[model samples]
Target: MPREVRELAEDPTGVDAGTQDAVLLFVGGPLDGRVEIREARHGEPLPTVTHVHLHGGPKVVHRYDLTPLGPGVGVYHLRPQQVVRDRSVAD
Candidate 1:
């Protein structure tokens, strides 16, 4: 799984910088403490085009993801979100 993430995070040119929602299978890792694979409210994996799981946040300042592209492999990059809200802008 580490190899998969390496490939994904390697070529920034291969992935869009704004796509924060990358799919990754958490086999095991040191950074596992920071990433939770289940939805915060549902406690279930999200059903998306690829990932069986996704990270959630009440407020996310930054994120990086490895969207699966093949068996044990994925396309990786940073994703964007409205981490900070402007009082002037309406939700």
Candidate 2:
């Protein structure tokens, strides 16, 4: 199930196009003891994300950042442009 998300605020281009770019988060699934959250906006996909360092490297990456938010809730993040696009799981 997707929860704990209402809107996303990220701007890397530093351009005010007079449009509010918001994103929804879909956090679920237990993949190697880490929660996965995908980005969605207006029920559409954003960008594609690939977990590069699957091994024991850094905790966060460029496209995605898997970090624990709470005891059972984990916070997943995407960069400004590219992330996990068109990816979702059924509840």
Candidate 3:
């Protein structure tokens, strides 16, 4: 995954230099099922995308949508979000 992200970093897609929303995913789990994304309202939990489940464990890709709060922002749905960087392209 890190190698893939490294290639994405050099993407010529004109990614800006700021924050971006990226989806993280775990390799295996109940989370492997379909997931949804909801909007975060006032005083509410931020929007999140459930990626996968760790077999009999908790949701692995349980995290909020990293909506870019600034420029250079990009989004990539990565099976391993922790490894994939913002504005990175797929290898």
Q: How accurate locally, in lDDT, is each candidate?
A: 0.40, 0.41, 0.38
Across residues 18-80, which tens digit of lDDT does each residue of candidate 3 receive? Answer: 232332222233443333332222222234445445667644564434343333322323333
lDDT (10s digit) by residue, model 2, range 1-91: 8778645445454433233233334333222344333322332233444444455774444454445443223445553444555458654
The TM-score of candidate 2 is 0.22
TM per candidate: 0.25, 0.22, 0.22
In terms of TM-score, which candidate is strongest? 1
For residue 53, give model 3's deviation from the true position in Å. 10
After aligning candidate 1 to the native by TM-score, how far in Å is the CA of 16 from where it should be?
A: 30
- Candidate 2 ranges with C-alpha deviation above 4 Å: 1-62, 82-91
**Order of candidates by lDDT, top first?**
2, 1, 3
Which ten-residue region of model 3 has the weakest summed lDDT?
36-45
The residue pairs found clashing in candidate 2 are 47-85, 48-83, 49-83
Q: How accurate is candidate 1 locally (lDDT)?
A: 0.40
Best of the two (1, 3) by lDDT: 1
Off by over 4 Å in 1: 1-60, 81-83, 86-91
